[model samples]
Target: MSHLNVNFLGIPMASPVIGASGTVGFGLELADYVDLKKVGALSGKGLAPTPWMGNNGVRIAETTSGMLNCIGLENPGAPYFLEHYLPEVKKLPTIFIANMVGKSVEEYAECAAMLTVPGISALEVNISCPNVKVGGAAFGTNPKQAAAVTKAVKDASSLPVIVKLSPNVTDIVSIAKAVEDAGADAISLINTLLGISIDIRTRKPILGNITGGLSGPAIKPVALRMVWQVSKAVHIPVCGLGGVMTGTDVVEFMMAGASTVQVGTANLADPSAMGRIVNELDEWCDKNNVRDVNEIVGTLKA
Candidate 1:
């Protein structure tokens, strides 16, 4: 049998596939269609200090190959998560990584400080969420701010810190280095580039927020490039995610410098996509006569 097992950011994953934040809706929701334990890990929707109702009407808008999201981080807030979701999800066999965002450095550190549970595997500092009106991208777009927030969260948490990065920046590698210097155990990118589409007739945008982060097949190439750039820029593990849909996409990410890849919009098309991708990964590696999966991680072909 092909080896599909791997370790991601110090957490032992059953495989190399993980569900991106906001796609799985807090693990408990996706427990019916697929077994959460089979996945590499689960990153919940970006959580904030307070619960968000999200933007008004029409949270999702379709594009040529991908989609735009105006979901605005509509989560149950930190207190609710620590009280309601965390305790219950901790029992599941899957690795639990909380995806978090902050309006201020202190706020980011505060949430990290409070999460003292042994069940959660790590802290994913989401400095790149484009679905909100505050803090996520602003902190991520600048290399300096990214480092500051990363260090803040690192100082507060005992769990390994994985900084989620934004693709809307000038130089992604610079930002990658910044976070690594701040003590990120691993880095994940690129979180949906800022994009928008207008309603032709009304001359208004399709999403209520007028703009959103685009994710799906359309952004895969760009993501692969960034992952390749950032992985070489820092020694930390890079978890690449953009428009990953199949085994080929996963392999591409691995070769381009991803230690792991997260499947996002693909899940919206098919819930069992992650499982199928894992199966395909084994066959692909076996056919190529690859002995160890990690051999290809960050081994970009010239």
Candidate 2:
């Protein structure tokens, strides 16, 4: 039998396939489509200190191979999540990771500070949101800020913290190492690359915010490259995301050094994508005579 059990920052997952933040929305929406408990874990939507109305309309636009989103990280603030959503999400059988962000470094620490209360399995510090006006780039684009933000959250929260990395930087590996040195338990990288799409007919942007993050098959190559480089650069576990659509894709990420892989746009294409991918991974592992999935980590000979 395939040993599907995997540990990310000490959180045990039945498999390494987690539902990416913003896509899974706290694990409630997909309960009707598939039993979320069967997957590895669920990363909740971006949570701020206060509820946000998010960006204007035209928030989502479909491209030939991908999608642009200007959702602006719209979400109910942190306190409400701890009081309400956490209770509901806690009832589920899967591991729960709170993905959070804010305008300043203190906000990120504050959001993570109280995560030890209950219902949250771990904290995924969201430093990669490109649509926001402040801290997204503040923490992600620069190595010093990234490490400083990670240190703040790590000092505030007892819960394991995973700093999500942005791809819109010069040296992603440097930022990854910074987070590791700052005491982040793990790192999740390749958050949607900053991008925009314009409608030539109207000569206006397709997304409501005029600019958004690009996700889907278009980002796979870039994501894989970063994951490969960052994995080798740091000692902490790396969770990879970006354009993963098949069991083969997850395997590639794992081989390239992803301790776990999260599904974002792929889940948007099919709500049951995580479940199907889990099943596919199981079959592949069995056929290949692989025992522990960890055996594949950092095996990318290329």
Candidate 3:
């Protein structure tokens, strides 16, 4: 067997596979299907300072090799999570990261401050959210706005901050650099790509929000390219996500420069996906004579 342990953003993880936000649902939901201890970490669903009802109507639509969702970041609010979920989260052996989302910079800071309690290891700030104060444009699309949000959360929380970046932008490196310069401890990318599915017969959009974030196997190439680019541009560790499915996929991302990887859409297909991917990664390392998984990080040949 090979060593799969990793120290990501100062948090010691047994593996490098983290449960992507919005897909894992607080980590406890998959307890029956997976041994959560084997996984590196779990990023709970995106939480706001207050509860959000999320989108209505058809919120999800299937695509060729992926899915589209406009779930609208619905959650029971941070107070509820801290009161009802934190106790259970503390019981889990692995690290628990709170994924924060907000409509404004202050809201993001507020959410970060609220989740600074025990049991949560870090904060993954979702900059993909719209900045309602800025005409509803996504904060991740603008370099300055992304930095402002990063700075706000960094000042608000004592825990490490990992700003999650959106892939809808033209120059992802600029946004990554901005967040890093603003004191982000680490970074995770690329958040789901903006996409839409159509109901051909109905002659209308398929999702309730008319468009949604796309994820799954189809985005893997684009994700790897971005990860390779941003990792080279920023000094902080990069946690890659998008279309990671199997153990080999994890290795690919690591070689492209991700220190750790997150499994999103795959978990929806197989609840035990993270655990299985961990085992597969171990097997690959052993077969390839790789002693430690970290050795492969950013080892990509020109």
Candidate 4:
């Protein structure tokens, strides 16, 4: 039998296919359509210290092969998650990761502390949100700020911390190395590339936020390249995500350097995507005579 099991930051996962945050909201809603246990893990929607109303107007728009989202990390805040969602998610037979975001270092740390309860398997620090205290610059864009946020969250969170990297950075390797140095247990890369769409006839922006994060098959190449680079640069494990839509794509990522992979846009396209990927991965491994999925990680010949 193919062994699909892998440990992410010491958190055991039956499979390496985790439901990306913002795509799988707390894992409860998806339970009806999917078998929660079949998924390796489910990351909660990005949460903040306080509830956010999110961006106004059209927050999502369709592009060629992907989609743009400026949802602004709309969430019910840390306390609500701990009280309402975490308990339900814990009942599921799958790993649970809390994706946390904030406008300031202190807020990130505070939310991390609040979400560090026993049920949470790990804390994923989302540095893609703008840092209002720092001139609205995204924490992940600056190596120094990324490191600072990682350090602060790591200090406050008892659970293992994973710093989610933004694709907007000029040097992803440098930022990945910085987080590694700041005590991040692992890293997830290529959150989403900034992009925009226009309605020519109306001569107006497609999304209310003007610019939004682009995700889908359109970004797979960039995500793979960054994952390969960051994986080689940092000692921590790298979870790759971009436009993965099939089992072949997951295998490609694992071979490139991803210890694990997240299914984001695919989930939006199909609620059963992650489960299907898991089953497909097993079949692929069996056909290839691969015994352990972990063996494929970072095995790229280069």
The local distance difference test score of each candidate is 0.85, 0.86, 0.95, 0.91
- The TM-score measured for candidate 4 stands at 0.98
Worst 10 residues of 4 by lDDT: 1-10
lDDT per residue for candidate 2 within 1-302, as digits (tens), equals: 23888978777789999999999999988888866766889999988888878998899989868999989889989888888777788888898898998777777778777566677888898886442445345568888878878898888888988899989888898899888999989999889887889899999988878878899989999999999999999988999999989888999999989999999998899998988888888888989988998899899998
Candidates 1 and 3 compared: the better one by lDDT is 3
Error of 4 at 280 (Å): 1.0
List where candidate 3 sits over 4 angstroms from the true fold: none
Q: Candidates 1 and 2: which is better by lDDT?
A: 2
Backbone clashes in model 4, listed as residue pairs:
none
Judged by lDDT, which candidate is best?
Answer: 3
- What ranking emerges by lDDT with the best candidate at the front? 3, 4, 2, 1
Clashes of 2: 1
Better of 1 and 4 by lDDT: 4
Q: What's the number of clashes in each of the models?
A: 0, 1, 0, 0
What is the C-alpha lDDT profile of model 3 across 1-302, one tens digit per residue?
Answer: 33899999889999999999999999889989988888999999999999999999899999999999999999999999999988998888788999999999999999999999878899999999889999989999999999999999999999999999999999999999999999999999989999989999999999989999999999999999999999999899999998999999999999999999999999999999998999999999999999999999999997
Per-residue lDDT of candidate 4, residues 76-170 (tens digit):
99998888777778898899998999999999899988988888889988999889998989999999999999999989978999899999988
The 10-residue segment with the lowest total lDDT in model 2: 129-138
Model 4 residue runs over 4 Å out of place are none
Worst 10 residues of 1 by lDDT: 128-137
